[model samples]
Target chain A: MGLIGGSYAKALRRLGVKKIIGVDTDGKVLRQAQEQAVIDEALCGAGPGLQAADVVICSVYPASTLDFVKSAVPFLKSDVLITDATGIKGSLPEDVQRLLTGRMEFIAGHPMAGRQGSGLGMSQAEIFDGANYIVVPAAFNSSGAIEWLSSFAGAIGCGQVVQVDAVEHDRIIAYTSNLPHALAVALINSASYNENTKYFIAGSFRDGTRVADINPYLWSDLFLANRENVLQELAAFSQQLERWREALTVADAQALQEMMREAAVKRKDLY
Target chain B: MGLIGGSYAKALRRLGVKKIIGVDTDGKVLRQAQEQAVIDEALCGAGPGLQAADVVICSVYPASTLDFVKSAVPFLKSDVLITDATGIKGSLPEDVQRLLTGRMEFIAGHPMAGRQGSGLGMSQAEIFDGANYIVVPAAFNSSGAIEWLSSFAGAIGCGQVVQVDAVEHDRIIAYTSNLPHALAVALINSASYNENTKYFIAGSFRDGTRVADINPYLWSDLFLANRENVLQELAAFSQQLERWREALTVADAQALQEMMREAAVKRKDLY
Candidate 1:
């Protein structure tokens, strides 16, 4: 019904959306979602059973996004504005746009925030507080749908609304999200030693690699689906690494100091 | 004084080693350190300017550690066990052992604990709480000096005293400290955007590259002095980055997934 789909079902219903239904393949999660009174109805399949709602928001793994969209295409209201809450976008937006083919307005949305811990239990109406809601528009998008999506993003308490194409969104996220995650994974990999050696590590090590502890299954899907852009960013990163190596290899203290100085100054400017 | 000379001064005075004197070049810092009453007396110069003591500890940057030791060799108490508090060992130990030849015992010491903040303001008697202190001995080192250094590390609350050679200490630190710092700098340098872009950056960006906000003067010296070992580790990291790039290039979902899985498992093992 709204951004996270299930958790805000009651709130959306109170706000007078006609009917609320939660569709999840996992029976346990579906029952738990309903038992929480977050949704008025629950269903297992994404077929005609989900057709009555004025809008539909899908939140699932990036790898299965297209498959889910294809399955739900026929059942949606003909004029329904379909949206998604996936991390990456390239394949899903293209596939969904083709499958629906102007029958419904397909708008892509991503809430640019989440915590270390996430799931149905951790879901909240306030989760989008002060967050930015990114609106990604595909080729078949209507400007009216964009305005409504922006309003939805605002109603959910998103502090900012950004507009970008799916391709551009994926590319920028490759630097902002994927690259940082990969770096964290690499840093933590080097610290897997015997217990004694690990005990000597400090808060800096713990804080530096905390992202490595995220759920692996979701991350693997996100990484592979965003592979092209992630790789491009990694190539840029490798060249940056080489510059550091060159500065270190020749014992060029001044050059190394300058680079580090610039980095420190730029970083402090973020304050 | 303690493991790194100043801690030894604080501990020895508490142990009734009367008239403790500190030696350092920074007059302002030394004056501040003295005002804190961590040391009974403070000398902001080389050893010839100070009165004789029961023991002398040299705590200086790694590159100048040997020079400081050589300067102190001629003026220490005849039986004084001269030790150091430098991070790396390979070249510094050799230089000290060569210079002090037979006149005094040169036992290299490293206190593995440190505060995120540096200098006298952050110094404390409990600075080495539950920390590992390594006592490195070269071929010509005296056994009595090693025993004395171990006791010194213990006096400063170094939880464990590990005995090692200079080469081993440097090798391990190449991976643990220097390489990690280089990686942080490289990651920070990968982007050239200004403060606006960084403002939208969440915890992941800050956490991944926080170490880039280090003292450039000190780090430049460290990277230059440990050039060879840092280069070797950088090469290894570059190879890993290349492997990740290859996985992305062919859209090899399985390879990328396996890489993430292996890294995740390895990282999880550290906890």
Candidate 2:
């Protein structure tokens, strides 16, 4: 059992995946992971780090994931189960499957938990506690592959296992993650560089704009890759903003109150 | 000395005001204040609370702060300085000046620091720590009143103190607090909410919508009371959201990235 991956390697080791092989492009990160005992064995190579492994999980960058999967296809043991921790699924599943010459099964998976501060040092095994694990398995994928993927997530203490079609997975994430990222980025940009303006910021501004500190390079690729669904979600958000603007324009106190009251009640009910 | 008059009470106590009396409409709150030693004596009655008060400071709700000031004006001792802790300064300052037909001087003040959860339970002598205390003294106000108000805020541990006009204070708050609150409420209301849809919500959704749980009644009054400036700020925010929509519409990756990048920088740099 080789846990050659990113931050999730730390979690896997904590879950009793003893023979973990840590892999990263960054030498500093590999050493840090070793110091933190996030991985038992460390490996960094031009090829995928999973050699003679029963199961191989890739937790690489979102853009390079499918490419990594393709490069690693020849090195994996015959009939080895491969999975990912990428946010999007549709394209990766198709591309990796085609690249593998019909030998390996790629199960697209996402752990619905991450801290803003990325990399292994910040990774914690407890991040999976009460978090959702979404699996987007292709149609031709084996039930064995799906079961193993679920078990992998469960072993790391994911609270719930969710399965959705590849297309649906991408669409939901376009709305859930991509669109919110865009909004945060836009809102933060509008403020620009103003020294005098920040003094008045309270907890709401801090909390609401927390995600704006994300790596834009990663987000830009994800947004463009999942373009259609993200565009739809963005339009929906605009429509909502317009409704709010209309209420504010007419000084419709009652409408504003109703909107806020409904949201307050519903939001208060959420964990 | 009256602690309820304004934030000056804390400072006055630190300056050895001796025999500080706390007055609030809530009897339980008054008793709690007394029990906690926030005041030397806690008076539930307005008449009894005003007795021998060398300085009267009003820290009431923004809308009715004027009425509170006027009602207490008659009982105030000669040469007693009047100040306030209301966020809005324009209306209150005028009312305080008009209603107080005595030798007492009126100075408007606002302490710009508070927790999300307000009221006496979260209140403390340390609430003013590292907070800005704005002293909006009236045009006819004597230097003595202004100095006393500054001393009051300083005594309460407010690190930064400044003076501004009533209109300026209201406009600034309308931009800072009211605009942000309205934007947050609108965003949360616009999100897709259903039993199944919520299953996909991650940290982004929870953090983005946390402020939606705020009290609508309190905020409704706040927005409506500061209708002019809040409406102006709402227009500015609407324009910003429109820019975001336009960027999304064209799938302008560079534009979106720039926006997000700026926002990220501003959020990160915010002190």
Best by lDDT: 1
Q: What's the lDDT for all of these models?
A: 0.70, 0.69
Tell me the tens digit of each residue's lDDT in model 1 across B1-271. Answer: 2224556566565666667777777777677667877676667666664437666677766677667766776776666667777767776776776776445667887777554335666556575767778888888777888898888778767777888787867766666667666666666777634444552455667676777767677678877767788787777766667767786777676776666666666556656
Model 2 alpha-carbon drift over 4 Å, by segment: A1-6, A35-37, A46-49, A101-103, A117-129, A141-144, A191-193, B1-22, B26-45, B54-57, B115-133, B137-163
lDDT of 2 by residue, B1-271 (tens): 2222433445555668777778777877777767766678766646745858887666666666677766776677867777767666657677768777668778887776655434666555565777777888768888888898887777777777888787876777776666656656665665555555566767777777767766555566667667777767656665666776676678787976777677767777875
* lDDT of model number 2: 0.69
- Where model 1 places Cα greater than 4 Å from the true spot, the runs are A1-23, A30-57, A69-83, A91-106, A111-163, A187-209, A213-216, B1-22, B34-40, B47-57, B73-83, B97-105, B111-135, B140-163, B191-196
TM-score (C-alpha, index-matched) for candidate 2: 0.85
What global local distance difference test value does model 1 have?
0.70
Q: What level of docking quality does candidate 1 show?
A: acceptable
Span of 10 residues, lowest total lDDT, candidate 1 chain B: B192-201
Q: What lDDT tens digits, residue by residue, belong to model 2 across residues A145-232?
A: 9988988888888878889988888888876677666666655555332565555555566666778887666666667778778767
Error of 1 at B142 (Å): 5.6
